[model samples]
Target chain A: MTACVIMGSGNIGTDLMYKVLRSYTLDLRALVGIDPDSEGLHRAADMGVDTSASGVKWVIDNADSINLVFEATSAGIHRSHAPEYERLGITAIDLTPARIGPSVVPGVNLKDHLEAPNVNLITCGGQATTPIVAAICRAASVPYAEIISTVASNSAGPGTRANIDEFTETTSACLEEVGGAGIGKAIMILNPADPPIMMRNTVYCGLADGYDPERVVESIVQTVDNVRTYVPGYQLKRAPVFENGPFATPGGVVQTRVVVLLEVSGAADFLPAYAGNLDIMTAAAVRVGEALGAARTGGRT
Target chain B: MTAAFRLTDSTLRDGSHAIRHQFTVDQVRAVVRGLDRAGVEVIEVAHGDGLGGSSFNYGFSRIDEMDLIRAAVDEADNARIAVLLLPGIGTKDDLVHAANIGASVARIATHSTEADISHQHMALAKDLGMETVGFLMLSHMVASGDLLDQAKRMESYGADAVYVVDSAGAMTIRDTMERISMLKHGLDCGVGLHAHNNLSLAVANSLAAIGEGIDQVDGCLIGLGAGAGNCPTEILVAACDKAGYETGIDLTELLDVATDVVRPLSPNQGVIDRDGLMLGYAGVYGSFLLHAKRAAEVYGVACDDILLELGRRGIVGGQEDMIIDVALELRQAADSSDAPR
Candidate 1:
């Protein structure tokens, strides 16, 4: 089994630790953070995993046995630690927007970047929207794609709050680099509702005039099915809506525009189900980590 | 009174809704330059709904808002370029792009009761070294006490200022005085007001807010905006000047822009019509005026009923879809009533 260590003992790190513990191929080694009083580290210790408050240095010192390190820290910290992980020959799965490695959206482009030393999960918004963007592009020539991801306010932790700018830039770049869109725009919303709402994403893709709407819808359904393999809670809240003919854009009239609404219901592994934003990120990380571990084990397990 | 105040021009941003989000680059340059020359402190540019708001749902922009923003930024010499961003409609990335392209200020808007959502964007704006303003849209929907609570949340989130946006132009002079006075007393940062002219009280309400020591106020050139349009910049500046208030704006220059550039582009004179007045009476969102009208036609219901029902439900911005849903239900109710027993 491939040994994995979770860095940053916050909501995301703690949730990731729980998923790693349940992984058949990945053995949870330790949870590391800078705060000694962090609930995540305490919970990890209680769950029988090694815990440290010394941060990434602890993971590096004990890198001898660790095959994978999940960096759940902010973008700035992740940038400083990524080279260290590479030098130590430990594969890093970055959940931050440092973009130290190629962007990986498991359902769409995981296989393309499996051999890289480090891979970025982009942001939760990217994970939730890029697959659909890619799906639309696969069926038609999409010139522009914009996604608005609305998550419950309570679900967004300090880390998510602190990295809002990085989240947008990284997510938009991924939509183009990974999702195959000519231009990409990303918007995030933290809905402050009582009994916090589930994570919802609205995706708008502008296609050239005369593209087949049926083929595009089929591609989207296929992509949604693939993403559901790892994120079971991920599903279309409604069918894709389409508008035809000369729709006005800054870049001129598009032949067709498609609007897709999506929702992610968390598995409620560690955090509540309303935190589908957090759940999708951690779940996608686990899926990628397992794929890497299986590859290392010669696909035996 | 010698109390300094900042004036923001929303001709290009909020005004986009009136023109169906089709502000050409030349139009933006003309309007922004005119506002800049008039010594306006801040000029906002974007889709009427804000950045990333160009979608099939929100009327798609004739030109990309970023292009409009860039044009406005390039045209302005002394005025700070600001952009309005409803958190759900515009993302942090859009803010970064705006800043990179020369936008110096961001007005992060949310519903009056949902100020907590502004924390992320406001924090990011401060981190990026850009001035941040929290805009609470549909301000008339909540009480002054509730508004104070929401404004305090924005101040704690690193907003340099918080605005009471009369999104529906629904506030009276008394409503403005109570809310702005309470915010002025409660907030550590500056308090601002954004009024629509739906009630024909935009100038009067703004004057009342200024009387309550509001540090900032917003207006659009020639009142070119959604609904009955915004407070007319020239008239507001002229009125402020007459009231012994110091806005530092060149009234003559503002008036010239209103007549020469903005007045020509206005689709209709900024006057309160039956539908526009209903927005104020019902306390509905100003931007929802056009959406409600379209939905009313599509669903075969009275537009006035949609606005009234939406207000009663306390529906806020970012809930545009609900407009159609409400209209459909109203249509069904009417259909059942007309059917044979």
Candidate 2:
């Protein structure tokens, strides 16, 4: 198994640990955090995984054995650690909004960026929506794509709250570079509903005049299916709806487009099922870890 | 001597929400020309959701807000052009363009509890060498102390002034006095108050805020705004005149602008209909009125029920997507209740 270090022990890092524990091609080396008394590290230790309160320094010392590092920490932390990981010759699968590396949504550009030192997994909204935008772009030229991501308010902490602008900037940029849209807009909503809702995304692709609806739907479904293989909970809420629009955007006019609604339910590895935001990140991380690990071992995925 | 305050005419910004954000260049020029002639100090203009806010979720703008801002600037004699920006919805690029386009002020808005999100935009506006205001939307949702903490955060981020926005139109006169007093006491920057009339308290709340020594206040010509509309510019000027506040606005001219400019745009903007009243009663954001009505109709759900449910969920501004979600759930609940147990 390819040994790896999960560099954060928050909900995301802990969730990544549980997901790695189940991976056949990946080995969980340890979960690390800065706070010595962090509950996340204690719970990880209870599960018999090696844990660290030493944070990034521990990852640096242990870099000799680690094949990959999943940076589940804040974007600032990942940004500081990115070049460090690069110098140490370790591949980092960044789950933060830091755009230091090329954006990767596994189903869309995973193999393309494997040789690179670090790859950003954008935000959960980006991983969930970019592929579908890319799919529609394949069938029809998407001039403008906008994605609205709504998650449980309870799940969003002050960190997430503070990074709203970064989240939008990063996700929208990925929709263009990876999803192939000419213009991309990202919006996030923190829903205050009790018994929190699943992480949901609404994607609207403003199509050019001559695109075919049948081809667009076909392309989107195929892409969603490809995503489900890695994320068992990724789902389309309904068939794509087409509406004639006079959608006067800041970019330009969108005469016609399709709207796709999606919801992601978590696998409940380390958190509740409603936290599909965290689940999609961990699932994508494991998928990347296994892929990179196989690339290293020259074995089957 | 009476208390004096600066007047901000949102007949162009907030008024866009009442008319579905379809303000043409001509309308903007007409209103800005009139308000500017009447000695109004600031004319806030943009798509109702703010700069760069035209989208599928917030509904698109007819004339680009930039072109509209240009028209307002060209026609104005004295009033400075101000643009409202919801931090994530309108990025720093928008602020730069508005500044380049001769807009004089930037009002960066965020939910009261989410003031930290505006740090970058507020600082960026200042960095662009333009004046900026921190607009705290849905101020009634938080306590006075919490609201002041948010205002202080904005002040630290370089806000020249901070405004408590009653996006819900739900605050009482006392609620208005308490929040504004805390902000005025805690903040070193200028303080302003924006009120909606969903509870028929728009003018009263503004008067109360003025009593708390407010620095600025907003009004719409004919009260042309979302929900039951905002405080009427004509009425506020007249009331301030009676209350001995030197607003510096020409009352007859302001009324003429209200009658000839805004009233034509929203002739029925004065009446507080059922949806308008419910918005205040439920303490829902005023902008949610139109979206919720559309959602209620699409799902065959009662608008009042949806508004109350949204209030119960503690919905805030910028979370407009939840209106559809709540409507769909309400529809499902309605369908299940119709079935045999």
Candidate 3:
């Protein structure tokens, strides 16, 4: 049996560990935890998985035939520990936003690190949205792209806060992969004061020479639909379209708008074909996982 | 004193308004160098809140707080390195970490009503041997008397200076002068100003505060910060120099940095204007301006309407900054309105 270890049982830790345990692809080895909370430990124990309170020690002690070590620890925590797993012949998949290893969004820049022993799963937000960014870049056929993500303050945990730079860089890089060239920018915000709301990402595409807005919107919609099929939480709340022309709600209530404009720049260099660009990103991420023999941890058929 | 005044630049930390919190280390470092060369006395290089130990998008330096500070301090040998730490989100340990990593000063900022938060952090920062300043954001929400009380408490809490931050970037020049005068009378510590350009009044209000004998002024290069941003550091330095006040900044170098450094990273045509003024009118804070901008982008509504609507939604009068949320709602509304009809 191919054994898999999930190091650092925090928020993403708990969710991802359960997914790994339920997967038919690998045998669970240990659910290492650092939280003193007995409830989380008890839940892991109930799942019939061995649990440890020590962070790095637990991983060091139990390393044998481990096919993959999933590091869901806080950002930066995995940076020092990830190389250790790799040295021990264990393939490490880091879900934390720390720049521990190459960022992998499955569909975006997955191919870049396919052969590497370590991979960073990036942030949950990046995993869910970069593909759309890639697609939008392709459809708009633009020179530059900027992806902005807004999350309700309370919903964004420490992971989102500590590694803010890494989160933005990874997202930007992933989009750059699809835009095929030129610079990319990523912005992420958390509203600790706002009510609980879904994580949202807005992609603003700027081309060397502006393109057709209607075609860009259509391509963005199709690309988002394709990505959502693969990444469950990757729903397109507001695809690339014009906002606030005729439709809007009253002064208050939950209002969210995502606008995409196809304005030209100095020259008409590289144009985006949204669908094709998204295809490249999405396919790249999955391809990386497949190369590493990663199976559906969240119960893939 | 016929001398110049001191200024801190919040461009990177506050600019999180325009793009979310997605700045790279290269960009942040550039901002630091620009602010420093322009002769800002202190460069606040990270989140106005404490450093996060987890994954966050918009905040201070993304790299380790220590690393960002050390790098900035190395580049800006003459400028003091300051960081903002909000209460509840930051611990005493983080404050200590900031000091160890070369942070010369720490600003303990809390909502006007939540003065206790900054007070606790201020005490801790002082104990750690770091210069501490207390900032009461959203000063509009609290009465002058209450603000005076908070400033006095901050003075007692060991804060070297007390700042009345128009966190919403909405304070008028008159309002800023009045608050500075009140705080100066009520508190024993030096008074400082941190203004947001939401109402196109950051410079005016900051200047007003300086005229009232406020000790320090907070600004950004070309006001490239949250919402419309803060007072321009170069402008403040020049004004203080011209006014014969001791700003302790090199006006010529600052202008060079603004032209050569800041403009390349995030270019701005000019200072905060119409929309920013409306934000002040709506009583929205700068912290929420980015969110308002995002909501305008998302919902496709006029940013002015979103700001007004947020004001109507009881969002205008809270310690919490939720401008992005209001923007998100506007975006969602815009989407639904256009649905397949």
Per candidate, the number of residue pairs that clash is: 3, 0, 69
| Tens digit per residue, CA lDDT, model 3, B1-341 | 44434677777555544544555666667767766665566788665344542112132233455566667777776778888776434455567777887887988776675454455567678777888888887787667788999788788889889888887776777788888999888777888888877777777888788788887778877777766677777787777667767766677877877778677666663556667677678777655555456556655667787778766654422222234445556767777888998
TM-score per candidate: 0.83, 0.91, 0.57
lDDT of 1: 0.85
> For candidate 2, what is the lDDT?
0.87
Q: Give RMSD to native, each candidate.
A: 4.5, 3.0, 12.2
What TM value does chain B of candidate 1 have? 0.96
**Evaluated on chain B only, what are the TM-scores of all the candidate structures, in order?**
0.96, 0.97, 0.86
TM-score computed on alpha carbons, candidate 1: 0.83
* Chain A TM-score from candidate 3: 0.73
**What tens-digit string does per-residue lDDT give for candidate 1 at B125-203?**
8988999999998888789999999999999999999999999898999999999999999989999999999899999
Least well predicted 10-residue stretch by lDDT in candidate 2 chain B: B316-325
Off by over 4 Å in 2: A35-37, A53-57, A138-140, A157-159, A191-198, A209-240, A250-256, A265-274, B1-3, B296-302, B330-341
The collision pairs in model 1 are A209-A255, A250-B63, A250-B64
How good is the docking of model 2, by CAPRI class? acceptable
Cα DockQ of the candidate 3 complex: 0.02
